[model samples]
Target: MQTHPPRSIQLVAIPLVLSTLAGCASPLQPQSSSELQRSMVLAIEREVDQAKAAPERRTLSLQTDLTKLEIRPDHLKIIEDEYSVDGYLAQLGALDTLDSPGLAELLGEDLLGQPTTMVPISLENAIHASTGNNLDVEIARYAPAISEAGVVQAQAAFDWTIFGEAQYQDSNTPQPGQALGGGSAAIVRNASQTTSGSVGVRKDLTSGGSVSITHDLNNNNVESSFFGATPVPNPARTTGVTAQVTQPLLRGFGSDTVLSEVRLARNAERGSVSTLRSQLIATTSDTERAYWNLVLRYKELVIRHKLLQRGIEVRDDIKARRVQDARQAQVADAVARVERRRGDLLTARTNLRIASDQLKSLLNDPNLPVGSEAVILPAHDGIEEELGFSLVEAISDAVTNRPELETALLTIDDATIRETVAKNLRKPRLDLIAQARLVGLADTFGNAYDDTDANRFVDDWILGVSFEQPIGNRAGEAGVRSARLDRMRSVVQYRRAVQGIVLDVKDALNRVFTNHTLIEQSTLSRVAQGEALRSLIVEKELTNAGYSIERLNLELNQQEALAAAELAEASALVAYNTSLVDLYEAMGTTLQRNRIDLVVPDANQLAAGESPMERAGDGQQAGEQDAEGDE
Candidate 1:
């Protein structure tokens, strides 16, 4: 009637039935979610390579990308409550709207966006901020320039100077006659005009000393009642010249003394630059800590969500069973499930709030556009292969690279230099001064150069040695001793710092190695628990029983295993990052490998001491533990 089935149709029908029978007999293929996560983790490690290569951006953009990673609404619900439904929906909607490349595009836009505000500033900015704006940057910035100006002022001390003056006067000459007559005979007058000029040359001496020579000339005309009866008379000229020198033999209270202060100022300036660099380091470190805290909180929230989802599934199953079982055992199971989910949700919310606070503090801007459903993807997932290097080698690298240690060592050097300078200063100040001058006295400038005869050339010089023990040389000796002690203290501190740094490296290395092992063991445990759960479910289904001893035991065992895996995962994530922090801190360098901008400030530029603001005036420890805490 159907013109006989086609041979191809027959062949397909036969195979279809056989394939169905084969599929029914086969085992389910494993889902391999862990493998997928592992692959993603590997991708992250590769991304870190890029981050290290381009640290100038510091991967804030990458963090944004990570936050944009989509988790289903149900997944989000497990971590949050009904109150957070809108936020979860908003995040999902954003992810959907962006499509495949949306996250990357958003991050790129944020990272490279044009700055809305810009202001011209420099190192002066730091100084002004530190000084609370009352002190102008010019004052501190130009202090060295001003001190240099002192050298110019001292140079003027070596130059010659000339000055000129003129005066006119008129007076009554009949004072004697007026005195005798009691007032009437005062018509006669006397008048006079005088002009004067002087030239001097001063010389600065080599050993904290100076000397000078001076010449003066004057002319005047006068008329008197008793002498001339005329108002004007022939001018009379008078000239005088003198020379003197003073030398210091004890204290350095002259030109050469300037060297000491200049050296100290230069050192101080260097220290300022170091201080700025240190501030920059501190700022970056704080930023990083905030960022990682945000990341950790996100990971914890993810774990809570997983736990919540499992609880929900268990609760639903328990409720369904209770409908048929009519037993308190099923009710208890349902209650336990509800409690677990509720507890997980609360913990997740608390963690989320803490993370948000940390991130907000770091951004330092309330107006920043953060994603509604921000979360940090762990840098890695699952156990990774154990791989590590020697702690001793790590410590050696730390000592060589740590900037704080380097600064401390340089401080010792600076102190030692100061001590040597003090020792040199212990000797009494001595100086020799000499001066040569050509002298002439006349009414005019031309006349002043008229007496240049070789024999008349006045040459005066002095050679002397001065010594003052200062009764005890107390100040100098005390300075030397104190500086030496400081130098010694610095040396000791530097060694101690080295030891501490070594310990830091060792601790980080231990964590890394231990974490690797934990990860491996935890993975095995998780796999075993999953298998045991599956076996228990199969057994329960076959028996068609409720709250049986075998089923309860299996459930309890699986839950314990799940708890262990959760704890291990949390520890692994925290330790992985904390170890990295310790490593970086020990090295005192960023993980970035860029060599383009090679400029680094000298140790002198580091901050001299801890800042008051960073100090804990409240005298409370952030990480203090309870008395019952283990050592």
Candidate 2:
């Protein structure tokens, strides 16, 4: 008995020391409600999966106010009164309904008395499915296709064309337009018949030149009885082959002007690809954010459930004490905590439901039925992994890979091409024209063919130049000036895009670091609470005395601490994952991350210019800021 007193004091003091040490410790196990949620989610998921696996007489059953289905993100107290009795009753009823053979399960109870099956959906599966079915991504996917069609349309102007024409004319003139022939001065009737046919191919050159080759055949017969003309008994047939070309000598010459449309179209095509890339990255990032939000809410629900369970235990313990020892106020306090947590539990469940709906919307899973009764469950929980980030590297990567940055660069390329074309157009229009022809004249078709020989062919060739200038040319000057301004505008926009990307990367990195640190601090506080609760539990057990009020109060404190810890833990993980999403998107590497092979028309093949990925606007500024609005 003498040695037992020292041992008792040591045992009593041990928990206090451990509680102090726990303030620096880390957490391992998540709250009990997570397991509860996981089970509930699994059950619902399995049932939904079974429904998809085999067709059934599925029908809509549960109905609620879907318009106000979601609550605001604010955490303001929405319970009617300070101690809402109705709210408490409602939560209790809900809990009872969700229990073994509960209301939620019984409503859709199977005919054969089989359990509801649940399907487990992992995060990766959700992302993949979301990328495929997300409406935003679907809308963006068509942009690239449209851009490709535009490029094709722009290039079609330079294709070759075949043209042919045929005509026959018969005419007779009487005394009004008479001619004399055969030494007769008397007025005679004049008549003529002619047939002509031509076939040709014309092509537009990329150097702003045009070439055409044509072959013409004609047959004609004339009769006259006047001195002005002589009557011919036979018809004359003629055939000729001609080739013509027109080359620009001043304005609209060279690739800059000739291929301006094609170049601009190619830039536009690249911009479209980048735009789609941005959209897809945004979709996946949002999917991740919503997914993690679901994780946090689920964990919060678990914490609330545990708190209520603790409150129930404490309330019962206080009741047992009230009968033996006088502790009425403590009993009331325990009951109050229970009711408070009951309200919280209901809120948590509501939030959980809201999150589940959001995840379903993001994934767009076909198996998940539409309605309040349908549920989509998460297969994975929050996880914390050690990660590192470099600000310089992030900025560098973003400058080179950010979709917006690339788009801005493409815009500059487009502006530059247009500017060059506008400048070139300011010159006077001068074209060099040349043509070569082989002529044949004969009375018969065979004679005409024989005349096609090089020696007999008539070398009818022509060469000339044409020039035109707009008076004053104010329109041309203004167009050139506007194009220069456009190029400058694109430069400013690109610089601004780089700054925005850098800032975005910086913010994401900061969040990641901050959340990781919070994880450590939250885990420590949770450990401390667990130790304090343990100390109290041991103190109450050591004595045959009735329950200690302090021990009961400590349980409440421990419950609060546990809830905070779970929240911090889940929040930290969510923040980390969200940061990575931002980082990858800012770097324009999400396509690579998701293993998507985006197809974009090569700008380099279309023109000589640096790509948007290479620089901002007019030049490359690795680390610079500018003021410009997005187009």
Candidate 3:
């Protein structure tokens, strides 16, 4: 029996094969994690970004991608399950040239039939999905509601409360005077009963007054014998309504003090809402940046793959040499070049995978379960055009609209309100209190009520004053001092934020202009390298006159030029696009730039609303567009 190491282990053995090439097979040991990671990145880059098929070649050219790459049954299942069946079928159709009926006999069961669809991701979709679903954005969205609830809680302190009470009592007592009278009349009994009910509403006013309106009704019955003369009993009922109000004559006498907590809550709510917007802005920026990075990595992988192919072609050319002048040293150099390009291609592939994973994380859509392990194909591709803006105007816009600045301003307002309250609270406590009551008395409850309504009740008025002072008023004094200091701090913070944003805008603006210039220069450089490589090919004609070293030099020069050109093109694409992301972030307008407005209505409003997130990323896409730029 024989055992084999892991496939990835076999891949790293390419280096070890050099030593064993003197014979046929020498084994290499297991590779380290870092080595594996590098190989994985470069391999993917070479295959995808720098593949042999350009946008035009992909449609008509015969491809072995379906055969070369192992597309497991499970990968097909996951993709098809997520996307439409027809879309999956179309994707499978594109990869499987063997599916044609005549070719089936040769390809056997390897031909694809039902394909899986994978949701393709675009930069626009990524940003929108992140706003609606990213964990950070979702968590931050609750801040406004929490702060609004806090405001409600603070205002509850002054809400009116209705109160009611009812009670009944009975008592009996025996008098000793009855014993001195006679046997039958010896023991005289005294009995009494009373019942009362009251209902009222009490409220604390924001204007520094406390008031209550109450209605009271009572019924009493009494019977007694004195000196053995006689006994009389009757039920007496009283009904009265009373209203009382108290106002602060000095301390706590205005909205500044009485509604201070409510004011603070409202200001805090503004700050919280602004903070939430800031979080969303940051999330949008991150998602955009990650999406573009994925694009760059994909393209870089393509470039690396192309270079590796070129190196392999050169090595094959050397191997095919039939002339006596062909040297072993040239063949060795060609072999070395191929290995170098292959290693680089593998590393590029791994980094591209990393970039894709990052974009998936930012998207964070629940339905997109492929984020865990499956490959994601971007929805759209190709270089994008940009719109320019004035630097001075951009800086002004950032300072005016940045959420951080708004939050700071709100904080300062909150502090100012607190300072006013604290200053007022430091005064000695004094209040003027007053009350009014109407009393109705009668032998029966009905008569008492009638008297109260007929203007026959007695009118009673009461007035009073109260005053108190804390021994040192230390807490009040401290509150005032703290509030003042806090206000100053908030103002400073707001100023600092303004200065920082201005500087950031300037830095981003410069990068945008610089990267744009580089994009143009890189395009020219790619063309120039291509020309230089062609020149080397033309020089091969001169080498035919027996200059063997010149032939070797020409091949090496052409390969180097080709590699440099591809790298420059890929780098230019990344730089120009990423600089745009930086510019958007500096202006603090990521959400706006993406046309993503999460300042959304609540559930009820959304249900009744006219709009939903456009181009929102939902599930794992079904069919992937070709790796080339979107059609």
Candidate 4:
């Protein structure tokens, strides 16, 4: 008798076999792919949170006293109302005493050489217009919709599909008469005709399986030559209904493998949204910068104009006293100063025109196209008030809100999705295929179908497993390795993006602080220069008849100095405002800070005639209506 195996060995072998079979059921099961991606993202976010939690990251070492920098509401009012030609002359206590003729002719007309229509626009209006109509923003708007379409296309892979086919055949063949029992060898003919058709519906499952149900029909008419054969139905019909399923147990298994494309497409859609947000932020910041520069140019033009008026006055006084004490050299000096001022005024006008055009380009308003001759007169001036910020909060906001960081994080997610798919691909392909059929045959198609339906049928069943694998699997291994590397690269890129955003926020804050300080210092300088100019003018008047060349030169120098001081103060103020814009952009809060809400229209909304980009404010609505009306 054959000896039985030891009980211990048998037990071990049986469990091993079962475990092997169970392992084959699902060889590659991990956490949900989306959860994996989210976990990785959270890890990165935790790193950022830790960075923000550091004690040193909370406060900034600021040079300017934050409280002392608070500006009065009426601080800019005097400049706005008293920085004109008559205003300056009155400020210098010479409004009624100075006889400055031809000042209007000297100041000249519009810089563009044509009559300019002044269009007053506020910062909010410019931002609103940009959000709706800026060309860069408009171009970026379609990306998310296109990426969403890609997601739809990828999902279509699992949609149910209907299929059908039909075919006809006629054939003739020769057979030996001996095979038909003719005794002598002779050729005989056999003829046949057949018509066949099948129809089916199949669906791909997210679990990496496909199932189908089909109905088959065939009709045959045949004439046969055979030896000792009984007569059979000449015209016969065969019909059947079959169901089949194919599922992958190894490679291509699971939702992660099957839905990889869909996940990638979704990631792309999110990335495109981030890209659009970045473009909007950039456009808004640019528009704010241009607007403030326009304001600065306007103020500079005023300063230049007043300086020219003062210069002309000095030249006229010198000419009027030329015979008394003004030498020819002194007259020449005064005239030269006036001419120089005139040149400066011309330069200032050109700058104003340029700044206006820059704002128009960014706004892209149909009512104020870049090529228009109209000038944009800023209705709002730059804010001079100092603002305080927490470095930790700013960094936290940048990490949370920056779209570039989001896009980079999405890149990592996409790479993770691809890596999951690649690792699945490395598994050997093991498919479980199953099929069942109810078959029937009769002289007619209707009978054949009825027989199958009435249980007078032959039932067929098939169950099988097929496995295939490359000996080396080099391609699959390489794919997995490459995917891992890509994920690593994306992580690095994400870190780089975070660092870049933090740097931007810090730099922006520094500029804001510096510019605020400059504003205060420049204001003091302007005030002191104004007093010095007044003192010089008073001294000259006290010795009006005993005026010397040195005194006249001093007067001219003091006027120029005052003008420079005024320009410095205005430039510093504009810079401070622009720095605030940059700060908001760095923190990804420009739209929120400006009280504008960005609304990205979906494909359905676009089809319904909604604007591609919208802002939730009166300015945007009014701008859109105006644009449509213009069109």
- lDDT score of residue 94 within candidate 2: 32
Name the better of 2 and 4 by lDDT.
4
Model 1: per-residue Cα lDDT at residue 61 = 12
Whole-model Cα lDDT of every candidate shown, in order: 0.44, 0.61, 0.61, 0.72
| Ten contiguous residues minimizing lDDT sum, candidate 1 | 1-10
Q: Please identify model 2 stretches exceeding 4 Å from their true place.
A: 1-117, 132-135, 170-193, 221-236, 313-340, 368-374, 452-460, 533-561, 591-631
lDDT of 4 by residue, 1-631 (tens): 0111211100012223223323433212244344434443454454445444552422222243323434343543444335433365455443432212332233345646754555666666677787788889888888888898999999999999999999999978877666335556656677789899999999999999999999999988887665423236658899989999999999999998899898889888888888888998999999989988997887787678888878888788788887787789889989998998988889988788889889888887776777877667665555654465666667666655778876876787778788899999999999999999998889888888788988687578999999999999999999999998998788778767767887898799899888887887887677566666765776788875425667778888888988998889888878988887888898888766766676666777655446554433324442344334334
What TM-score goes with each of the models?
0.55, 0.68, 0.70, 0.80
Q: What digit string (tens of lDDT, one per residue) describes model 3 on residues 1-631? A: 0111111100112223222223332111122223322432343233233222332211111111322234455544443332221222243342222122321221122113323223445555566667776778766666766777799999998989999999998978787554444555456577778899999999999889899999999998876666533323267888999999999977889877788788778777777778888888888888766766765665565556556665676677666673655688877877888888888777776676577667777766665543454335454343444544554446545654578766765665666677777888889889998999888788888888998888687678889899998999998899999988986676666566666776787687677677666666665565445555544555655667423544655766666775676566556656656666776777777766666665733333233222233223333332221222233
How does candidate 4 fare on TM-score? 0.80
**Best-fitting candidate, scored by lDDT:** 4
List ranges where model 4 is wrong by over 4 Å: 1-113, 172-191, 223-231, 319-333, 454-460, 545-547, 613-631
Q: In model 4, which range of ten residues has the least summed lDDT?
A: 1-10
Question: How many clashes show up in model 4?
Answer: 0
Q: Candidates 3 and 4: which is better by TM-score?
A: 4
**Residue 624, candidate 1: how far off, in angstroms?**
39
Evaluate residue 181 in candidate 2 and report its C-alpha lDDT on the 0 to 100 scale: 68
lDDT tens digits, residue span 424-539, model 2: 89999999999999877788766876787654886678899999999999999999999889977876776566567756866776776776666666545544444455555657
